[model samples]
Target: MNSLYAMPGNEAFAELLSLHTGYQRRQLLLHHFPDSETLVRMAPPTPGGDAVIVCTLDRPDPKALPLMMAAATARELGAARVGLVAPYLAYMRQDKRFHPGEAISAKIFADWLGHTFDWLVTVDPHLHRYATLAEVYPNAAHVVHVASQLAVWIDAHVTMPLIVGPDQESAQWVTAVSNLLCAPSVVAHKERHGDRDVEILLPEMDKWRDHTPVLVDDIIASGETMVQTLRCLHARTSLPPVCVAVHGVFAEGALEGLLAEGAGLVVTSNSVITDTTQIDISKPVAEAMVSLCEANPTETARRTPA
Candidate 1:
C-alpha cells in the first residue's frame, strides 16, 4: 500500500499524479498545516503497511518537524519505506558556499532529509555546478525527473523559432530542446549588477535577424535577466517571439514585468504552481515512479528501519 501525502500547496499536483498513476483518491491523504502544531495535529492516525510519499513546496525555512513526525508515524505503523516527491525542490540553488560564512544549503538540507526517506525525487533541480543528483543526495536513491513535456509544448506552439539560452547554465536545456526540434540555438552571457538588475549581451543577429527567437532558462527569479536580454535583442532589431522558463519561480511580479517588457509569451512546467502557464508533467513523472519501482522490488518489500 502507498500512502501519498499531499500538502496544502500541492493539491493540483496531487490530482495530476492520481490521473497518471491511477492511484485511488482514498490512497492520497491531503492536509493543510499552516504551522507546526497544525501539522502535528493533522498527522494521519497510522500509516500501517504503506509506504509514505510526501509532497510539499519549498518553504523559506522549511518546518522539518512535521515531515519528521510523518516519517516517524509511518515507521510506527509498519510502513515498508518512505519517500519524497518534490516537483520544485528547495535549498538546491545554494549547493555550494561561495563565502566563508555562507552555508551549503543543498547538502545540509539533503543530509537532514536523507534520514527520513529511502528515496528522493524532484524535477530539474537547480544544480548549477553539480552534474548529477548523487552529488546532492549521496545517501538516498536520487531521481532527477525532467519536464520533457515542455519540449512537446514548444514544438506544437512555437513556429519558425530560434531557441536561446539566457546563460551558459541554460545551454544544456537549450541544446536538448533544439536537438529535439532540429532547430538552431544561441547562448547569451549575462551580468548581474544588483537584485532584479541584469545585462545580457548577444552576438550580432545578422544571421538570426529573420527568425523568431525564444529564450529559455531554468528559473526566472526577478525576471530581470530575461527582461534585460529581451531589451538587448529589441535594440538590435525587432525582437523575436518570446521566452520560456522551466521553473517559473517568477518572484515578485516577475512574470507581469517580463510580459510588459514585450515578451510575447512565458511558458513553464507545473513544477511550481503559477498563473501564466503550466505544462503538465504528470506522464513523465509517473514514468519515473514506475521505473524506480521496477528497479528495486525489494524496495517495496523491505520493512521500515527500526
Candidate 2:
C-alpha cells in the first residue's frame, strides 16, 4: 500500500508508527507549525500519490488544519484516495445535541473530514450512543477500532483482576475484557452531582474484596467519574492495584488525580497518548485500515492509485 506520514509534533509517536508500520523513517514527513503562517508555509508542496496517514495526539484545539491541507495536497498529487489514522479523534463525544441551538459536532466534524478524505480510522472513538462509525460518517468509509490491546496488556500484568466499568455505558467493554481474562466484572452506577463532582454505586465487594479491581472506561475526560469511583471503591473495601482505561484523555489533571487516589498503574492505549501508560494499539489500527482499504476498493481506487 502506498502511504505517506504527516507528523503532528510528536516524535515518539511518529517513531512508534514507523516501528509498528515498518515504514521507512524518511517516508514520515515531520511538520512543526508554531503558528498558522508556519502551517500554511510548510504545507506539502505537492501530493505524492499516496495515502496520507496523519498521526497526532489530543490538544484543546488540535492542528487539524495540517491534516486537512495534507489531504487536499494528496488528492492534488494524484492520490486515488486518502485515509486518516487519527489515534485520538475529536468531537466524537458530542455525537448528539443535548441543548437547543447546540450543533452536532461529531457529525459536522465527520462531514468536514469526509469532504477531505474517503475514509477515517480511529481508536476507541467516543461514539456515545452511536452504534458504529459508519453511522457517524455515513458518506465516508469509517473504521472505529477498539482497544483490544488493553485486554492483552491487562492479561500480561493483571492477574485475577476484577474489571470495573465506570458507568453503565461501559458494560460492553468491561464484559468483553472480563470474559477474555476469565475474570469477574462489575459496573459502577454514577450520577453527576455537579460539574466535577460525581457519586458512584459499586457492586457488592463479596467477590471483589481484596481482588485487583481494574476500572475500565472508554474515555476519562475530567476524570471526575473515575476519581469518584475510585474513592467509593476505597471506601467500600481495599482498592485494587490499578485502573485500566481505554482512552486516557486525562483532561486537566485527571491522571495525577487518579494516581493520587492510590491507583497502582493507570493503563491505557496509544489512542490518546499519555505519559502514564500507552500500550500500543497500532496493530489493531493498521488492521482496521487494511480492512477498510479492502472493503472499499472502488472508493480506495478513486482516492488512491493501485
Clashes of each: 0, 6
Q: Which residue pairs clash within candidate 1?
A: none
Looking at model 1, report the run of 10 residues with the lowest lDDT sum.
40-49
The runs of at least 3 residues in candidate 2 whose Cα sits more than 4 Å from the true structure, single-residue gaps closed, are 10-36, 40-49, 140-147, 193-195, 294-296, 300-306
Best by lDDT: 2
Q: Which window of 10 residues has the lowest lDDT sum in candidate 2?
A: 40-49
lDDT tens per residue, model 2, 38-124: 342233323333464656447635566666766666666565666777777788867878778999988988777677777777777
- Give the clash count for model 2: 6
Clashing pairs in 2: 79-303, 80-302, 80-303, 80-304, 81-303, 81-304
TM-score of 2: 0.86
Question: Residue by residue across 1-306, what tens digits does model 1's lDDT show?
Answer: 455566556677767776777653333333555653534323342344334354644553555665676666656656556666777777887887877989998888877667776666677778876777777774445454453566777888877678888778788888887888887888899886778777788876667677678888877878888888787777554655577776777788888888887888888887777775557875676656545534554643323343
Question: If scored against the real structure, what TM-score would every candidate get?
Answer: 0.86, 0.86
